[model samples]
Target: MNPARALIVDLPGPDLTLEEGRFLARHSFGGVCLFARNITTPERTARLVRDLRDALGHDALVATDQEGGAVLRRLDVPHPPTPMGLGALRDPEAAREAGAVAARGLLDLGINWNFAPSLDVNVNPGNPVIGERSFGSDPALVAELGVAWALGSEAAGVMSAVKHFPGHGDTQVDSHLDLPTVNKSREALEACEWLPFRAAVRAGVGSVMTAHILYPALDGERPATLSPAVLTGLLRGEWGYDGVVVTDAMDMRAIADRYPGGVGAPLTLTAGADAVLVCGHGELTPHAEHLNAVERALRDGTLAEDRLQEALTRLASAARRFPGTPRPYTAAERERDGAQVRAWARASVTRVGQVPRLSPDAEVLLLTPDQPGVGGPYGDSLGGDELAATLRAYFPRLRHANYSPTDARAARALLDEFPGAPALLATPTRWNLTPVQKELAGLLPARGGIHLALWNPEHARALPLPALVSYGFRPAHLAAVAQALITGEAPGVLPLAAPEVV
Candidate 1:
């Protein structure tokens, strides 16, 4: 009854196989979310969506976590820089333009719902998960840019979901690892954490995803996912958010570890969420079992029918708002959006430190970490090979080394051999440094040496060095950083939270 509540499934990419589409149709799931693994090209992605819709005979909610920058999920298609990179421009108009470009790209690939424009106010620079993904450290800046991005997405006819509601910015631990707890008082949350979510609600964001975080001050024993104080009391009652409230992936360690009895989906739904996400099979089986239990509870009159009806209504309203249609991007539009994203990326790059020029015969080593999971292949130069090529065009004698964690010692030995030369360390923000790399960083001359932390700025903060440079590490950002480094010009302002000197 009522479509058995809505569920969003994650696909490898835009291109779905016949078997995958059938599996989706058979399950009668409400929607699907795309990642880079499923996308190889725009045309192929659009075709896959079309095929799925035809097979399903119902408008499936096709969505993507296309937040741009380092969080970009679809590499086969072009999209703009991440929200933080756009925020770096410090221009609302630029942020809007980048948002429009991303919206256009998603729409072209037949993605209607964009789980993006993260409204999380990243006040904590050491936040591993949300560093470059967040708009900025300041709540006001995040609200302004987030609103612009939301409006842009709506304008392009793509439904936008501002997330992780309540807020996930200030926590030190990643929800992927364990449940993060926010001990800040209610007043503090309203002033600092809730600012951007409130702004998004005012701007008419279509959906808000709940975090797996626990706010002890809000509700003592339960995480936000299972806390009525958070979802019903704060979001729906106080803020009066009428949009769909979807829970973050239940498969994440935060919820899984706590809810060992597999009560997440039911608890989340009962707690006021419109939909609960069962991200992977490990969580899906339990979620399905929970749904059956919920049905049983309804039969026994333990779960109120009205509560289920309310959730159904929200899901139906959201689905009705998004009329599924194929929105293809022309070549000219693709180029235009690509250019806009690159311009924003260029503006977002920031140089945190400077290094003295090395001798003409010295080598400038570039080390990149390996890509995890089943997504795109890790680039030879930390996804900045093109930028490196551009650098070499001008400085042909510049030597570079690209190494994974396994070769950390070799990479460090190479750097040691060239001690007379100025060293440059380039690695993805996602890459965790090996012990050898850490030791090498200690050995390098602090003043004239440069450590360029590409990708996540949070990673840079962890390094035990005094002078560290952070480039948000998108393709355009890489180009911007390379140019800035060569020209001795800083790209943007230092992060609000700078690394402390040891």
Candidate 2:
């Protein structure tokens, strides 16, 4: 097989430039993955995909990480709640609806493949990366919901890849910055990490994306992305998964920082990954180096020609399944698609502790931490102004304040000024808050108000009070929190036990 068919590259911008076009035309890249940077508008996104295909001379698979919630790349659209939120509803149908909505939106943007339905069982609450992104901590629940998502996307004619294979949910380190190790023995992995993957494979998932993590008990030296023991011996030989094996973004620090240019890409492919995904905001020249390395490996007999051919075959099969013509939708159809997302949001609210009864005439103080952006981790940061505006819809007599925990004066003033009024504090889940932020979050419980965690189910445990967790902080998540606050009702249950409960 041509080694070029084993690589997937990314564009530098929303529009295809001359250099990018030339590079794309010269290489038989198996796919091209899009990001938020490549999407200026729906029209521009569709145009870019078409342009990439035109340059490549064939319909290459176009993929995106439109997993909804915090990982949503498409902006200005209604996104379903995070997978953890869906798991909280204890309804696989909600998971399917979320997947279908994501598929419809991705298809509208000319994307054929979705890197979604993360099969990782979020067994560790401290995992910074996979927090609310996972379906839930229970392997059975994750498997059930993950399969529903994969089938839902497939129903929309979009190829689905259950990701971060072998589980990325037990480590605290983010693979984007560095490699994380899962020390579980083979038996432990089979019992926990491998459960969802097995179910996904049984459900006929089209692709499996290898995690950029090390399992010391499996292959002590190499990460799963480059370990033949993990990829070939276990995933293929033991599990009998004949579907495509795609590596996580080779540009990520776990690979790029560990192995020099062109090293990780070829190593991953040689390790049994059918496709090496190189996605980032850097130069495209590295992609050429990766392709060249694959070519050299094939010629030198370092990488078997048959293995390369097998990958090409898988890519061809995936392309055949998604012919790359995204069916257009009417405004009404788009609205209907968005309505499902909204419905999931409504049923995905989880409340902890006792629901406080507030007097209609009493003033409610909304406390949000001072952050740099408009929202916090996983999405646009909710600036002090926007946070207040969003909460005002639910609490009409609301007064907003932003405090930096580091400033003693600000903390003292914030604590003193809001004594009489009931306060609701917005906290981040994945954020390991500073001492000051922790102090502020801890102080909120004593002040007699609800602790609203905006990121994951575990954030409230950091507080000294009972908290309401939203699994996400997107518009839908925030809206759900607001609705629950206004109506004093929470329909969803916590997917994972809160830190206090444990």
Q: Which candidate has the top score in TM-score?
A: 2
Clashing pairs in 2: 374-381, 374-382, 374-383, 375-380, 375-381, 375-382, 376-381
Question: What TM-score would every model get versus the actual structure?
Answer: 0.87, 0.95
What RMSD does model 1 have?
Answer: 3.6
Task: Please give the lDDT score at residue 383 for candidate 2.
Answer: 64
Off by over 4 Å in 1: 11-23, 55-57, 260-262, 281-287, 355-363, 367-394, 402-409, 416-420, 431-434, 459-471, 498-502
lDDT of 1 by residue, 114-205 (tens): 88878888887657677667878888888888888887877787888888878899988888788898889888988877998998888778
Minimal lDDT window, size 10, model 2: 372-381
lDDT of 2 at 227: 98
Residue 120 error, candidate 1, Å? 1.8
Per-residue lDDT of 154 in model 1:
71
Q: What is the C-alpha lDDT profile of model 2 across 388-441, one tens digit per residue?
A: 787787677888777775663554575687688877777743556557666666
Going through the candidates in the order shown, the clash numbers are 4, 7
Question: Which whole-number lDDT from 0 to 100 does residue 451 have in model 1?
Answer: 65
Give residue 23's lDDT in candidate 1 (0 to 100).
65
How high is the lDDT of residue 151 in model 2? 89
